[model samples]
Target: MPTNYYKLNLASLPDGLYNQETDVKEWLALTTTSKGSFPPDSLNRVLRMDSSVELERIIGISLWMVGNVLPFVLPLFILASILSSTGLVLLKAFLTYVAVLASLNKFIFAPMFMKRYKRKQLSNTDIKDNQYLHTERNNQKYNSLQFVWPESVNRPALNDKPVIFTAIPHGAVPLGITCYPVWSKLFNDKLCHWTCAPVVLKLPIVSSFMKHMGYIPAKAKHIVDTLTKKEENVGVVLDGIAGMFRSDKNTEIANIKQRKGIIKIALRAGVPIVPTYGFGHTSLWKIVVDPFGILEALSLKLDISLTPFFGRWGWFLGPPQRVPLCVALGEPVLCPKIDEPTQDDIDKYHSQLLQSYADLFECHKASYGWANKKLVFV
Candidate 1:
């Protein structure tokens, strides 16, 4: 049975009950300037109305309805409709056509796309602003580190034999030496017939620049191809970006836990690993400390950073400390087959590479003042 309600008296209600009744005044004031009447219940009902039908109708009219209309467009539409209706064979034909177009795009259009993509990538970064200064300054100094030895010491000849040159800088170093004029001269005059295998050529912007400067991409295929043609002489950065600073009390070279793609490439190529060291790079920039670690974190996240120098110093090329750099190079560790090299072998070679780099750093630290400060790996 339905329930019934009994009426109650409101004559004894308190005046305080009407204290919050300011709505009428507000409504009256609003009505003086507008022709709208308050219809809260009606408005609520309209707002609560289901919109699913309208939404579905709009979507259907845009896509499904438009597709349905395409079949009425004469001979071409008739052929398309017939083919789609038949399925299988027609689908294969369409797929074949698409595959041909995709192949064309891959061979021709993709390279253009990559070049433009790389250009855009470089343009979006601040790598160009300080590129010349940072790269050239470090390259000049580091390259000169090789020339410092007495003529009596038997320096390795730049023969056509493939030798891996690895540069290990104590802290943030510029990445321009792989294609500097001094290196270019060395390659042209001494190692002219010898092809360089710089790992930087594998990087995006730097790779493009390296290619233009006659250094090809350091892919396994390319390295193998070059090695087959002539005995290739390659230069690789051992520490890469990791060697820039110490992390967890160990330099990036010291951290053997990560993948060393360069080491693997050298091993596969059967190239001699030569460890080169450069010091005094940390002195190039004044260290800015952020207590919160916000700025450092942001720089790393964005892959763009500033290393401010106190004053401009003329480029200085240190005498080549071959013993230190060569100590890291040690012996040429060979990996027979480029294709079948194992992960364990790669790891062992990478550990050896790190040890070589560490030895180079330790030997040259005194000369560069890097010996005093704790090498904190970031």
Candidate 2:
């Protein structure tokens, strides 16, 4: 097994020597838990905080935000900063024109480009297609995020059969999930096909970027054709929109308990269902709760999250959270192919898949310092 990156504390060292007595305790307290799991009592104690973890979140989110929003935010800030001081009114007008053009590119050009890209995407086939250029790399090529998975176990290579990966506990931004395309390479690209939401493909500029990253619409026809193709693997964030609802820290809440349509699809396709979960997924956001259920109502209506959220940058979109996030994959559960699986059949396999999710978390959380996290069915 590849050794994970070590996060040891050099604070309170005995001169140049390391103390074995406090080593284990400090490692557990410092490196293992998510930011949300940090004890609140020590929150204000500046001396007790580790700068490295904080720095990662700040740096990660900064790059992500700059990449996502700089084209729109930077010009306006520059124009506003120099508008009053400028003696050249023509230069100010040019800057204003540039800002408006940027806005048009965001609001107009990008969405159309994405829709055209979607229209041109290739049909599903047994052989994997590189119809679009995706910079997403195999895990071996990605270094920014340390993705750890069980190395000792075998997944019975997805060579001859169709398979589905059911991801759980939809986090705020699912930054962890975004890295999955890179991580899924562990299972071999020949077997993986990503199913993305249609609305995500309708975003101004991001929609084009997402398609280039190999996401196809999650339509019934698309799914059926993909699965029917030899050895093609489908990845689904099975937890529906409700998974975005706020829950207690370290809770295993997933909307999976309420949503089980994947069960029927797997049964019909005769594919094995792989239960995947991300510990510390929710910690990516700072969600504002709505007591009267108004937020969830509006979110459902808009098909977007209503619970206001931000990252370290504390803006509309936050930076990468410093929280430790781990996405773990479990052994696939075989489902019998049925033309029409009754509720009992769906329920039976759903429960089994749910159990596999729980077991997967239990087996790996210790390595991720999430041993105390509960596997909530909700």
Candidate 3:
């Protein structure tokens, strides 16, 4: 999927012995050796998989799962054990059940879920105007103290030209998605909207609330229409469902390099790419599955990803921590229009867009308490 993984510019990085070519044989050879000492700021870890920190995240995620979801689902699981002992449909009737579920999900469920919103006056609040897309109608769920803006950086001035916010590394439902209005006010309420999974708006008894709140499914047509028709900006988690599974110990190894679909959208929709970075997102919650685990792979097939992510409940509302969430918005990178964009265009601009994140992290890591971190693009 990576057309040119070697286009990364290592020269700009501080000089040291880096496996730039990524010599796997050498890496395996050196795996057990005592790691040589390097300067403090030098790249040491790939994705911030620090044992202590990651362990804390893992424990947090486990508590949420074991304490929260497990209690509720355990009964259904136990019932399944009895039913399975009597030859149940858990595995034998998988195809039959799935086909039935799919049919219901499409025809009966989705329409009924959307009907509630249509019956209400929620649709009138669409933020398609060129003016600010956010407002002061703050949601009670958000605590302003948690999301702190970086003082070292100033918010970029937005214009009438449509902007595509490429929110990368899909770290634990980025605080922006959770506390949108406060997030908007933090940025002087620069009007912007976000996209979510189709499942979010397709569920029974739940879809109406999200639809009323202005969340759209992350479909290409919906994204294209929202960006162009409304003349408004949209913040998309570029990784979508797949990115949630891609989170790992490394805080910096993002999958965005090969995911050039955003580049194509920018080229076609005539929007500039804003490589927005949420420095502490990946570190917020510890997900307890392998990046390439069977659950992750299976989730991809279903167009949804699941993670029993866990974090401290108090931390969610408590005052900002020492390393609080600080989002950095980068300057817009203009893309050249091509009637039919080639691989060269995607690769070339994806590299440039990747560099923007590196620059953003390097420039502001210290003020945000990530001084020892290096934004490595793989």
Candidate 4:
């Protein structure tokens, strides 16, 4: 048995971890006390927090605002200036302030946030005794995050070899990918280095957080170095900035028809590609579409989403919606390690990966409340 293999105990988790209306009931259906027994109430109580938990939750959301939400405020301010009577003078002032703060983010705020997060982690006294505390700690920040590993996929033997994890439908924030720590704890602490847009590493506080979280730049050389030379698992967002524009409440679009670079990277390193989908990832934000397709073009060229978006509260404000955040990992598509894979080899593996992703979605769509929805590959 692999060191990472642990019995799936859906019953042992806390109440809010899984959405009650969805497949969580079905997940726990077979585990009724009539069969054997459930975990003790004391274990559940560990996750249930006191008054301090609320404060911690607020701070977590605030930090999220700093890292994920702050960079775009200047753009919003510019738009507001155009619409409102607010003159360009005020806007220029705000722009200058934003610039100075962005510069100071790395030197001042990033270290402070990192220290606070680390301190909170160390403060969890029960972390060592109860391994599930990893998930609990992560949920402190992301309220509705969940992981569903279908029985069809084999348990990742992290000790055996490193695997490439490809996450789909990159949300406005890609919150699921940032949950790498929780994923690492499950796989016996073998960290999967996530690849992010090169621009992300240049952002103010977000870059620091990404670097602290062990994110590699989404460059071919950097990815190849992490897989081949460093011999570690790597995770990539397949659709990236393009998918952010396509995010919608009614439909799920995977902008991956043109994404074959990662496949080639996997082939070069001889690593298996795991088709991972973050269901309800798009539900976290409401994107304002550009009918003219102008924002999409600019976003691709800039390697970042310039599309106007909003969270649960309103335009670029408030925490993400409390939707059930479930990331499902599918069976791996094995590929041969070829130093110089021809176009034929790349196309073959890419096609297999596409099928794997589609199959993964079809297998577990209904469980997460997407019964009638189909994954449209653009």
Candidate 5:
């Protein structure tokens, strides 16, 4: 549900009767135009439905369905139908044709969409008026997507420097990326790009959507070139898929002990690296365990996440739990430009990034109500 729907109150109605479609239609009609009349049962349904339920559904569909289920499942389904069905010769041929088209669509379609992605300058009023920013039911403050920095750190230092925001505990999904509207506001709507694994970038519709959201392939060449050629900031998941494999509600882990590529890129690009962490991201969804580690091995091998089953409240493939998302931006670690960075340079800066990220987590965990949470680096 959009944030505005959370404001409505349908009082004095019977219990256990709700219809989202009817209520949304009526709401839209009332708010947007008088062209359509409300359905007869709209009031009754509106009164029965809790705003939280709708919010959960929205979170589930947006995060789980869009980010996880659809992209991986659809292509696998198409390929399985094409290969395993021995009897349907004609159908197999058609499915094969469709698969080719989907693969081709991956390359041709996403760039066209990317070219048309426009950025509009937002005013103070525009940022304040954004309903999504106010959608955090857990917190009344519009700072649902909070960015906390150390008291000693200057805000303009972060604002002026071209940075590589290294986010952690990749969570069930990168919920931080989904909050583009809020974070983009923090950067004054300046376009910031994030790097993603090539596996997801090859899926049909998912690739286009990711491209529109400023995701590029997580290749060293691509990251280096983009940082060198563009004036915008770049974001990288230090833990990447390996970090996601370790994501659990009970145990918070960052698989970044060996991840030194981003540090090298930052040094080469002459940009500062910001150790970014998102609180409440891991609590959003619970991952079902693969006791034998088959899924884990496959995930690491393919460089793509393959959680066989995951959701909130034991609902398989359902929406993640509703929680206010907050990202902490640590003091930027300066990386001087080295046309050809050495092993010693990478090692020194990588240690700094780890310390900076750990410091960020320790300093603000209590403030963000994550006092008991500890970030373990694997």
Candidate 6:
């Protein structure tokens, strides 16, 4: 025979009781038939309640919805939508628009967006005003040495003629820097063709930085077309951006887990696979592994980290290790002109590319400080 009011006041009451109370209140508010059912006194009191407190609660609910519920619900909703005629049409139209927008954004709008975003983000932080690094006038001083260039002594020349280089993500080496020197030295010396990914041209600070080093954003098709003119040195990163996972002194190519777009591009373009490695690249920063063990994939996708070289040994460009940090320019594997490449062809080339990388790693293991490390498949 305990009073209902006393039961509501107890701290030991189940959380669900509070939830049920809230639901009842909501239902009561919604289903009010007569004005007196919701007394003017009660309505006035509720209306007069702290708006800031209500707002905070709403925000918390919204954040929970977005962070937890939306991820699973959105995919299911999209799937259900796809099963309907209107939904399918809308989805198709949306996808087409998104694809077009992505292409345009990468090639054009991204640079501007990056610059604006960087400036805004920096302005909000307590960063010091360094005149040399930040000012437009000091841009020339920053251009003293071309940081991005090839280590090869016999660097090919890139005349006004365009040459294409696919920027890959192996050894976590930002090939952009190494490739710059290659382009300038090769193009300046020989005056042959040179080109690279259009995405590079659209990076805010990076685009200008690249242009100064003599690289234009070149399409893959254009690169192949240019190659047909003469024996063109079209460079490509076999392990695209996923190469960033490689641990220091690890001989195994960690990039095999990802898609081999570079292989496809190489096969289509008929370019020789250049198995390259960069020593002391990953040592540039510290990587935090997922603690929960559940979000590792998502964490990698987001790349949630401090600045590229913060709280660790800042990056250093070693004098390119010709042997181990090696660029094994393998013999050109001729590709057939086919409408669709077979899986076997893809697998064969992928294996060859992987073996070439392993061989190069083995050949220079001692010099690069990876002699003791075992080549892990993953």
| Candidate 2 TM-score to native | 0.64
TM-score of each: 0.42, 0.64, 0.59, 0.72, 0.66, 0.43
Compared with the true structure, all predictions reach lDDT values of: 0.37, 0.55, 0.49, 0.62, 0.57, 0.37
Candidate number with greatest lDDT: 4
Q: Write the per-residue lDDT of candidate 4 for residues 1-378, one digit (tens) a residue.
A: 211111233324443443212332343343212111112221111223344333443345434554554577667777778987675676887657546545554355445544543333322233222222233344433444445554333333444667788898887766666555444444433456788889889898677656656778999999888778877778888898887877555578899987999888888888888888987778777877779999889889988777777776573534566555667676678888899999999999988988978876775676566667788888
Q: What is the lDDT of residue 141 in candidate 6?
A: 16
Q: How well is each residue in 159-243 modelled by candidate 2, as lDDT tens digits?
A: 4576787787776656545553332344444446567667766766566655655566777667767787545777787875577
Give one digit per residue, the lDDT tens place, for model 3 in 204-253: 43456456555678777887777678666667887665666554443565
Output the number of the TM-score-best candidate: 4
Error of 5 at 28 (Å): 32
Q: What are the per-residue Cα lDDT tens digits for candidate 6 across 278-365?
A: 4334443344444454344552454321112222122121111111122222222334444456777787877776665464445444
Clashes of each: 12, 4, 8, 0, 1, 23
- Model 4, poorest ten-residue lDDT window? 34-43
Model 1 per-residue lDDT tens digits across residues 149-212: 1111112333335555655443433322332322322322222111333433354444454444
Q: Please state the error at residue 354 of candidate 4 in Å.
A: 1.0
- lDDT comparison, 3 vs 5, better candidate: 5
The C-alpha RMSD in Å for every predicted model, in order, reads 32.0, 12.1, 16.0, 8.5, 13.2, 27.1
Question: Across residues 74-101, which tens digit of lDDT does each residue of candidate 5 receive?
Answer: 5666666677765355446645644554
Quote the positional error of residue 319 for candidate 6 in Å: 15
CA lDDT for candidate 2: 0.55
